[model samples]
Target: MEIRWLEAFVVVAEELHFGRAAQRLHVAQSPLSQTIRRLEASIGADLFERNTRSVSLTPAGRALLPKAYRVIQDLALATDAARTASGAVHGTVRIGFSGAFNHLTLPVLARSIRRELPEIDLQLVSRVRTGDGVAKLRNGTLDLAFVGLPLVADDIDSRLIARTRLGAVVPIDHPLADAPSLVARQLADDDFLSMPVDGSSAMTEALLRCCIAAGFRPRITQEVTDPYIMLTLVAAGLGVTIAAEDLASIMPRGARWIPLDDAPLFMLHGIGWMADEQSSALRAVLRLSEAILPTPPD
Candidate 1:
């Protein structure tokens, strides 16, 4: 029932390994294991199933995870509120953003924060994938995040900031490079370079959905994490890729972006924060965003 026990439980659940969880918590494995045992006894349920080689969460562990995250986050916010009341600490806001914001949105937002909210400490974490961003927001590790839209988390609040058509990136001399636009099926047989298929990437998920809707799964030749690198590889003739059409402005010289004729296949970008967030710093940033960020096109 103690906070430390819940912290240990959450860390162990995330790592699924006592050794790694202990290392992360800077505690001995024996103590970490004892903590989890104490937590389970208090809750009257077994939280994990462990064997010699593997550790997996039990049903009780899965059920407790999200609630534990909220408890820890709420405590942290209460502490922050108390400190802010006394002016002991100016607010610190941690913001996570994907690579898509690097070229413009992030820089502009940073400058605006520096000029308008000089007392606030702005921590910018770059290259945060959409899924990871959402997770961080829920756990209170991030105050806000720029993420792919149509986000369905009940605990998160999001607003659309931009929308852009998804398109194909190809080598300049590739057969379809000169086409004005293309249907998703046109690239079915081509070697496709894509973002990693782990559920963390919104772009990768969009690409798969688009290909499947087009009647064939894309032949993925390589999985790249960075969009710039994905385009660079495409420019080298390694393979073609599906990406936001706006990226064409920053793409390498040897690559061309071809728009997708599939109207529904587009990327929606948004800023998201926990629905129950009570941080004044977060509210300030959201207010500034409304004035500084562009509205999505209809």
Candidate 2:
């Protein structure tokens, strides 16, 4: 089938609604529907199940989604490679990073890449969470990513870059903020803010375990995805949070980071990429990253 057919199919699978998908593709709804029908005919299976109320992917469509993402991204990478071969730029590398704790590593890596590999065009995507970054790597969208660790994907390879102990962030005026460190039980009654349990990072899981092990289930008042926002909420006295100790460096004016000494939970960070990645520019970045990024203390 034509690439446009695959493109249309992917968009429809994502949106599930024909009208929204057509709007995204800037095409007439009728033609978009026709394209989906043509793709289904070529594949000999229905990709979507639709009715008056809603649209949903069929089993076949669900199976095709990841493959379609990889195919599209790979083709784009190939086009970039071909352009570079024709003297466009030496190569282009797309790097995804979660900015929550990489405030130091990301900037250092970017500057090093620019200075040492001047011919390579570096594209940095920021604030990408660990789960999203891993998906992008698997689908060939990101050449490299800084991810939260304990990553267990066979198709991906990663190296541990940093690890920091998990701690609590509380309002500056809170009663416990003056403590040098605290055990989990000390804050059991406090209203907590946390990352959503579903698809949460390893750090969040550890935080929950820490609280439970301390003999009280945490009263999580809010679930958040961004560390900065979590800290902001803490500063606003909405709730306290458990986050990597490194976040203390960027804690907002009204927030105070207190070390959680009990159980000594830690958050691991790593740089990850697809196992079969072959881009020379990406490999170069990997090499430079190994030399520059910090590793957990031995």
Show the lowest summed lDDT stretch of 10 residues, model 2: 83-92
**TM-score versus the correct structure, for each prediction:** 0.74, 0.78
Alpha-carbon shift of residue 113 in model 2 (angstroms):
3.9
Using TM-score as the measure, which candidate wins?
2
CA displacement after TM-score superposition, residue 259 of candidate 1 (Å): 1.7
lDDT of 2 by residue, 102-122 (tens): 786788889999998898889
For candidate 2, give the lDDT of residue 242. 81
Q: List, residue by residue over 89-133, the lDDT tens digit for candidate 1.
A: 457889998785356678888899889888789999887888989
lDDT winner: 1
lDDT, candidate 2, at 251: 93
Worst 10 residues of 1 by lDDT: 98-107
